[model samples]
Target chain A: MIKKFTSALNLKSGHVDLSHGGGGRAMTQLIDELFIKHFDNDLLRQHNDQALFSVPAGRLAISTDGHVISPLFFPGGDIGSLAVHGTLNDVAMSGARPLYLAAGFILEEGLPLADLERIVISMAAASKAAGTPIVTGDTKVVERGKGDGVFITTTGVGIVPEGVNISGNRASPGCAILISGSIGDHGVAIMAGRENLQFETSIVSDSAALHGLVADLVAVAPAAIRCLRDPTRGGLATTLNELAKQSGVGMAIAEDRIPVKAQVKAACEILGLDPLYVANEGKLVCVCEASAAETLLAVMQQHPLGRDAAIIGEVIDDPHGFVQMATTFGGRRIVDWPVGEQLPRIC
Target chain B: MIKKFTSALNLKSGHVDLSHGGGGRAMTQLIDELFIKHFDNDLLRQHNDQALFSVPAGRLAISTDGHVISPLFFPGGDIGSLAVHGTLNDVAMSGARPLYLAAGFILEEGLPLADLERIVISMAAASKAAGTPIVTGDTKVVERGKGDGVFITTTGVGIVPEGVNISGNRASPGCAILISGSIGDHGVAIMAGRENLQFETSIVSDSAALHGLVADLVAVAPAAIRCLRDPTRGGLATTLNELAKQSGVGMAIAEDRIPVKAQVKAACEILGLDPLYVANEGKLVCVCEASAAETLLAVMQQHPLGRDAAIIGEVIDDPHGFVQMATTFGGRRIVDWPVGEQLPRIC
Candidate 1:
């Protein structure tokens, strides 16, 4: 990622200009000083246009995600960390162990050098924490008005172990649905940060890497687990509906069995939003055979990222794949697919 | 890339709305009717978050590129085709056969649906022409003011055949340098489009996928091909400087032996841009043993992309790693590392 710099950079108060991304000495210097000094991997150090490696013949999973979230920094995480976690989780959903990452950055001209460095450092830390190295990357700068501060896109490669065959369409008529921890944390945090909400809100995004917890679940019941998916973007209800439709079935659940933090519930109610539709970054939905649900719950509860794991619903036989929920008042309502204007750039 | 659409999209007379990227029914509908319809493949039709595939045990190369070029549409291509070519070229530089690609798109609200569809169709055509498939992808939207039209990022995965080992650092002091074709087509085309230069300029970008050409060269003489690199953003002079520095050697060339098209030369002369410093998307620089130069030149000239191949320079031993050019005049001048402001977002 870097080359040996001939001089030091003015990172303290420097701003990115057109020359920094012009593929000249200035761009090389920035990479040498900022990117190379931090990423510091053997593959990146080669300074080649591509990173080369050898892998054994096996089933490999590849996922890509683009993060264009507003308010680059938030209560619990920044765009840099979120970019890494988002792609990693996507690859992990296949019950695969992420091996490498490739990132591409689009920076707007005049962005503060300090802020860019902070994001890079945060991204490196997140990758390192998850034991995945960014082997290759590309950077481009746009005109001042053509872009926001910065947009990051990450692609992850993972190798699924033998005997693991997780996919969204594997959910059948009798499988049970389980979640790893609470919901609405990430959505509520982004809303509070964006709106300021006229008070000191205790909301923080639950944007943690869930591959480790997924590894645990896959290790315990490789075949019994039907599918795994992170409840992101449109949140738990939307994800459930997707799974049911993909598997050609329906779902029924008890509202009391689902888990939600008190603060998240309060914030959603105040904002006129339903908790079931809000996003959760660090949580996941797991579908498995009903016989193995208890064993899987025990395994999930033993992990740090999955203490609040619960069996929220069970698959049912319905041609329309409707997700019906039994409310606390003993009333039944269908959980329809989410519709309407999206919270733009919410990661 | 797509899901089943409940209804046809508002394609002919509509613009992209925020809901199209909101991870709801609207987003799915857009993807189903547009992206999926164009980029349909067996792996993509599976509808998994990640694409799973198996490969033979071998060395693999990966490259990532973000295309944020201005004037999204130009003479030879748009941002979509450029995105595919850019990354495929990067992987081809390693003497690898590109097999799969993953794409991420960031769309700005209010973008015309017709323009987006045009770009998507062009990208799908490019991918098909190159024999590589878009296996998995993602989409995110930013508010109108936060982005320009659209930016695309692509990552490529390729496998290197046995006995072909290429690296930037493989050039020795006694190696020879060669170029595939003429320079400055892409840079001149972009300049003419952006500045609306006076007179009818015949310049068109030479953006192309070079894996087929590269495979021919590697197949003929795998061991003699020491290093291969495409002169994209930095052009021929800057690319030579990078190779010299990486190989810890110097380079000397005769100006009369270099190849340049008549139209590109006239355009560069009028625009006050040096053809040697202008970018060329479809060109490449090869460094190999002095003994194999003629054979390699013959091999390159036999291919369509390398018909104008020429032996431009020879590597030399020097502590400073300078690239000296014997000019048309009687003097020798050093081609120093390019410094100063750059032409941003050219490719």
Candidate 2:
């Protein structure tokens, strides 16, 4: 079957055209040579519109996210890796073991075949490394000017272990707030890659899958961890505010305790942006019982992705749900959620 | 909590801006008043990055589709209904009853809030009518000119019944081929909606959810049904060719027996397009045992979505796997898979 369609695709020099998304012979050839060849699995090999499989009886977690960063190729990561890491982190935040993924691609006509292939290869590598397979997918094409290079929407599903109850509304007073690593790396990296930006830095996107670290944390303290969130689009400040509002509590943190790379701080200062509100692809905020803070901090520190982990703040009993920061000058100020995004298309 | 953010949104006069997708206060406000208000469910109300729920032990089917149809509105349907029906139909093609959906939206900046709300309402109505609730979702905003009006990607999960097997590769020689209703209406409607088309017709899109009809068919003849497919995208000819190749058999159908609306045919002729290669939204092609064809046909005809159901073809023993159609003028021609899509972005 593949032999009959291999001649239709010119992977070396061809560009995506209207026929590639026409749901005809060209589309089949593309799916066969590029997608199926890379994402080969028994379920996907069935050539059915949907993949069928059995699941164990347990709680399931589902998440979906769209990736449309301006620069397809960023400093530390590209849109492909970000798409997978973003959705997988969302599922893992629920203390679920990530299992399967479904991807949808919106490609602009006339995109280089080489670039598309590179993105798919990167996605396949990321999914394989994370132990999640993309089982089913769909592709659509628009006119040249109607779309950017490409946009990917990934949806993931995972199973939560019994007795594990993690949610955004589970935080309460006396809970300890901890961050996995330094913030502002991803947002600053994206900004540096933009054409108008004239800054140089070694800071790279913190776009790594956190399911492994999450699995380790859930193994040690399933009940102690109250909630988990990854600071993505609106960064740390927005995430904390959301948690505070959702849990109906307040947060107090010492500014000196939060970890921020010097380069990121310099970039933020120059750009007039707040590091607290910049995005981080691979960092997470964990709220756990105050008693388990030390143990979880040690556990996180042992992991490569969490070497810079820190216990930055604590939850408080306040009806107003204000997040306050104790400045280095020994004064307190409100860390309000920004009205709008300072950086657009930061992913 | 809602009172504090009520003043930020002016739905009647405002347009989507970068702030709405920035994951900031504006994003939260939009979500609270629009998405959460309409897609209100227990899982979504949790306000977590992911939705967690328990599922029964069984075989699960998952599918994803991207809808980027040009001209947000058409004759009978819009992008919202197409987004829901397309993915739901993909799941139903496996003889599964769809349970839940996850939606991801990429909104271009400057799009009217009213348009977004209307699309969301239509989507919610379709989901409710089909009994498939959207449990999780994410929104991203792109710069103006970087995207069309909006693109929606919907992912669905359904449960396949035990002891039932349906796949594209399950067709065998002597199997009966059945279609649910008329074809080409969707593609013609979209083409008519595009600019510079001077034709006038009352042909409305056949965009609908067909899971209810599929459920009735499965209940009556689960084991007898060999394969199922929805003739979307490249339409009936492409779908038939794909099934023939997958099942390693040949197909023989009479062109006169396959139902095509008079208006749709007239439009196709005027545009130099073949009705067999045009798209359909609310249709399905089923392959079943020759002995059980009558019973399944009766069951499908009783359903509202399948009043024009007909068995217009049969599988044959041919290694070449060719699909041959007998013309109304007493001639046989090879119904080859189209080399490219005749109508792009028709959904």
Candidate 3:
């Protein structure tokens, strides 16, 4: 931490009050003592509403994500770390190296100050670990009943290196689809935390920043890679559907080749949910040319974050643009978007 | 509207559900039918997770703001337009020309689809009026009780012209302080709307984008201007206090010279609020050299947003860095940050 100002927050046993967001001395104390204390960088210490920086010569990619995950503290990661990972991954999916991030927080009145500090500490840690700092941010407060404990919105700015082009529309009929790792870990962990379900084995959320892995992939096959996406919210099935629709192509995914942890599979079976539709925070789905599949998968597995990477699907020519999956049971089914009973606030 | 995908939304009677944020077909429909339809442009049509655009080679200023204002619809401005204007102004405060914006929305489940559409339309209009488009966005839905109706967080990026530098710590003793227009319009309007107070004259929010006026000011006195800030939540009093503390200087202002509309002043009197400490969304304070004061004021007054512009005060040397106001009654008093009863969610 830069330690621009000493801690003046009553973090031991204090709760957030209306005045803390009143834009008065109280708000200043909270920001200086808490936010600036943790996210202290030269850009943030200027104490301006905006942060100024330089952008390299290249196309700029901008992305944003709103995280309202329930159970602020989850198994493998909390909302704080999840917020950083989610937005960073979004920017990275564009084949751009995330440069900086800006966060907007809405805190519910009466939220414990200790909890807020913990979240900030964890968020700062995640940012530092990812090498992307939270440069500028805003804080707002709503009445106790009007908001949950905390909702974080992160916006990221990134720069694509020269000669790199990535877009959903870039995917064609003869592309191969690959995933970074196992699916449904993040969603299952949050579900277990919220339901207080005791599993035979611990299932942790796979919430990690993927920009480093994305950087490596871009270096190896910058031209062959067509589109990149993180299977979050509605998970892998929905992600493929989005790409298929955008590219005006259909997909043929083999279920047996898809990677899924044994623990996550068991949990989904017990909960009567489809792992294909459950969210994953750390993993990524890449649609690339046929020539890049083998090289990309090898390069991806070389990275620790993508050790279990697999080539699970391929793009096919179909006017309807459907995503069909060959199940392990020797049956084929159209993998459509999830409709009902979908989890909310699962990030 | 680009009309990429025609409106498939059940706008008359539908309510938002978890599926809208579930990364499923519903979410796509909501995004394409509403957000894309209104915010359609070449960049947004890419349908990628992130928006990629060319940025000029220059300094970049980035900012983020979370809008949780009560009464989603206010008299003069709603939360939608306010979200865009507030963030653009923040970037403009740094003497930058805003280029693009990214929005993240947190919507409460069970909220009316009609209301969401209305807000999005208004937000699109605001972005269009300012010539800054919403290039990228994300939406998340929380349970009904966990969130209010809706909260929008907007992040903006702008390019600063060469040789123009603005910062909070640049103010100095003997500097001139000027304001764009009347204060307290936004706060008073919100208070009246919330309290259901029937005043003789209706007070409307002064919520407008200030980048055009900022551009003019920068063109006229780029190097002479020390710092620029919009008096938003803590109003002008807290803003001056912030500048004083930041620049390591004190301020002496003439209360009689600060422009406050007669209707807003009356409304404040009835509400026992100090117009000086009330919020103004569209107004801004500029600190510049004494030599540039007259020219800057003349340039500002030529703009519609600064028709009521005035030179209110000047920086004074004080070791304690206190802000003192010369009251209309010919006595000086310390202008301190408001301590309590701050109208929450004033945005």
Question: Which pairs of residues collide in candidate 3?
Answer: none
Instruction: State the iRMSD of every prediction, in order shown.
Output: 2.5, 1.2, 3.0
Model 1's DockQ score: 0.65
**For candidate 3, lDDT tens digit of each residue in B134-177?**
99999898888999999999999999988988999888999999
Q: What ordering of candidates by DockQ runs from best to worst?
A: 2, 1, 3
Best by DockQ: 2
Candidate 2 residue runs with Cα over 4 Å from true position: A6-8, B6-8
Candidate 3 chain A least-lDDT 10 residues:
A1-10
List, residue by residue over B1-347, the lDDT tens digit for candidate 1: 12335667878888888887778778777767788789989787766789998988889899999988878998789888998899999999999999999999999999999999999999999999999999999888888888888999999999999999899888888889999999888988888888555446888899999999999999889999988999988788888988888788889988878899999899888878888889888999999999999999999999999999999989998778888999889689998767633477898
- What lDDT tens digits, residue by residue, belong to model 2 across residues A144-220? 98899899999999999987899989889999999999999999999999999868898999999999999989999
Q: Classify candidate 1 by CAPRI docking class.
A: medium
Give the per-residue lDDT digits (tens) of candidate 3, residues A119-232. Answer: 999999999999999999998888889999999999999999887888887778889999999999998999988856656559899999999999999999999999999999
lDDT of 1 at B289: 92
- For B59-115, candidate 2 gives per-residue lDDT tens digits of 889999999998898898889888999999999999999989999999999999998
TM-score of each: 0.97, 0.98, 0.97
Q: What is the C-alpha DockQ of each candidate?
A: 0.65, 0.81, 0.62
Q: What is the lDDT of residue A326 in candidate 1?
A: 95
Candidate 3 lDDT score relative to the true structure: 0.91
Q: List chain A TM-scores, every candidate, in order.
A: 0.96, 0.98, 0.97
Q: Give me the runs in candidate 3 sitting further than 4 Å from their true place.
A: A1-7, A196-200, B1-7, B195-200
Best by TM-score: 2
